[model samples]
Target: MTPLTLQTPEEHPFAQFVRILGKGKRGARALTREEAREAMGMLLDGRVEDTQLGAFLMLLRHKEESPEELAGFTEALRERLRAPALAVDIDWPSYAGKKRHLPWFLLAAKCLAASGLKVFMHGGGAHTAGRLYTEQLLGPLGIPLCRDWAQAEHALANGGLAFMPLGDWAPALQRMIDLRNTLGLRSPIHSLARILNPLGARLGLQSIFHPGYQAVHREASQLLGDTAIVIKGDGGEIEANPDSPCHLYGTAAGLNWDEEWPALAAQRHVKPATLEPEQLLEVWRGEAEDSYGEKAVLATLALALRGLGRAREAAFAEAAALWQGRDRAAL
Candidate 1:
């Protein structure tokens, strides 16, 4: 008979998940979907210790994340989101601020709104420098940034377009996103935030800087049972560069697909000038002649239109027409 040993009850419930990922190279392994969900659930519940939280995140960062992990984490996160009582046609996330160009995608979203498509856009910035954020541009451009779900509903009902900051919609995750500065590295939250889709919109448009993330986003969206378009948009914002082939990954009605849209321009233009919110307004008004900018806007809109179920030819034609026929005075 052996003396009974108390096997130090498994560390903290959350620590078990951390140890699963941080175990040595040969011993460590990616968390299963359920494990990932439980880990994120613990983090969101504020039960994870701070020290463990950092170590867990860094361990994940070191190994990167699998699509299964993203799906689990995202599923856990969406559980905490509070959506407005309204219909949204597109779930547009704008996390990466524009650094190389003005946010041409904003104009595209406005174009969609002008065409009666309700666009629910959400994002965060300030973790990076010298970039123009959608929240900052929307206000001065006269578009409203919603302070809460009720305000988002009002904006959608009356204006057809609404913007929500991450901090307002999901403060817990926003707190994690904000940690980018302190950690000196982006955690998996960066990728997870783009797919939040809080409103349960039918279509989600996501952008990632890294090309590999394209597949990760596609798989995660499929797991969430939502349709989404993931692109390596210009400067990691949702705006596409018409001068380069745009790689697209998405699922529609349960069918997953990938395609490459040919570039619209022969030559890539140099960065025009310091991006200005007023410039966005000017282009929208048709008072500015930016061939590159206009093509970028229309091309980006075409992707959105296509994602929303318009035929390829029809989407492209409709996108160009909408850009040309937009209500310039609305902004």
Candidate 2:
């Protein structure tokens, strides 16, 4: 009897999610919100196998994540975050590193922080080549790099700004991001991380490089009951390109709207031959002049202001004032 016994391998619990997405062309469809939440929770909890994780991520990359999926993934992440009860006004996520220009949006965040707004900025490491990441420049910019929730709390409570690496708070998400090299393509974690707003900030600022993702982010923000702005920003960062008209998609007070911001320059500015991190310091220290850089900073600042409930004209004006009045020696 023992020699004649036979057994079948038991199916993995996480296999169902992979099957949901890889069920052939017609049979496959997007995961529902509840399914997304369950799958993300399983991944974040380390319940998913490595093979299953890779396949699931690639499946999502092929179809792109929907608003419901994004919202659900964000909800799962928020449930596991060790974030403090901080009065953060702005949630600034920097994932797409700068390629053509210096990160002018970093200055925009600094200006907001200097003006007494609690700005919580988070980003992953430089996983890709030839791009300037936020964490790389935070030290040079004099922004506090928080490694944990306690440090982040202290930094925001005292200096009104904090930059935390993704790995510190969400190691699973960071691990997924690091898979970019192994997978040879970016996964949906990049998009999911953008709208995290982990501390429940009043305003979330998101940037997308791919066309059509702006609407996804805006709608996902609405689903999450978060006030947020989405833009096709400079180099896929939340920095406005002063050389072109910027279109904004966002939700506020339970209403969605769109606005077009006119170009700040008549002629498109040429990208710098090379990016110099020190230039950020030079411009902030009042030791150098960069017309394009300054305009980009101001325009990005205006975008954040608008997301925070300021009107168009007033937001631009206030952004300029904030720049002009910034303590030159603060950095």
Candidate 3:
């Protein structure tokens, strides 16, 4: 293992990734499959420092990581952590957490649970957007944060919910998260974190703000040969929308897997009313009109379970019912 103190840019695996990202359309040789994997390896071993980490992050954010790079980085990061025992686990890679009202990814989690799905929601402890994040949302739902690797793994196995706080699990990479504020620029780490899957679950859900991600996610699933469900989640988190049909992507074997999801749901898209924290919480807590709050969550969890293109709406409904039951049990 390269000691964090001895690591330098040239020796770091992230070096090539920094190059591809830094050149900003000028870098020679867009990283090939193997090279992309090597760069991801650097991330896992802690060879990248704050400045280089920041630089590569920004460069990729500017250029947007290639689908190949995204998959490679995901492979490297997931390999470092303990793979989950189950093939089915809801691991949503949510990039946008601090939304204006409340981030509803946790509600997504509850919906999936109601459908009898297990979820692993991960995020940074704090971000500059000045709104509470997943950590705060989970607190109201009785999910406790895990501080160590063993505890996190145990949570995934024994409990349906676990929080992989980036600050606690990967501090070096976490340091780069703060650079977003100092430079006021987004970076590759932002995308990478949302793609990071500790459990290495074959089926997972991810969301992104950049529309470019639709293509990238499709490519990533194919390159890695992992069956994953991808969504342009509402505001970059893995929550469904009542306003529109969020297109889905399937990926496996370094190629986009068969995307059997409908251009539209089996049914028509209904208008989800604009919601606030109070109106949404009961739905989030599974206590109110659940069409949006409940359905959104279930969709994510069901996608995690049903593989590429199985029973989309029904799986979503199942997830909602599972979490709704959990919510009632607490009462």
**What total of clashing residue pairs does each candidate reach?**
0, 0, 19
Candidate 2 per-residue C-alpha lDDT over 102-202 given as tens digits, one digit per residue, 9 for 90 to 100: 99899999999999999999998898899999989888788999999999999998989999999999999999999999999999998889999999999
Ranking by TM-score: 2, 1, 3
lDDT of candidate 3 over 303-328, digit per residue (tens): 55566345767766656556556555
As for candidate 1, its clashing pairs are none
Displacement of the residue 313 alpha carbon in candidate 1, Å: 1.5
Measured by lDDT, the strongest candidate is 2
Quantify how close model 3 is to the true structure by its C-alpha RMSD in Å: 6.6
lDDT of 1: 0.86
lDDT of 3 at 262: 38
Assess candidate 1 and give its TM-score to the true structure. Answer: 0.95
Full-model lDDT for every candidate: 0.86, 0.93, 0.62
Candidates ranked, most accurate by lDDT first: 2, 1, 3
lDDT of 1 by residue, 11-72 (tens): 77787888899889899999998888889988998998889888988899899888889889
Best by TM-score: 2
Residue 165 of model 1 has an lDDT of 88
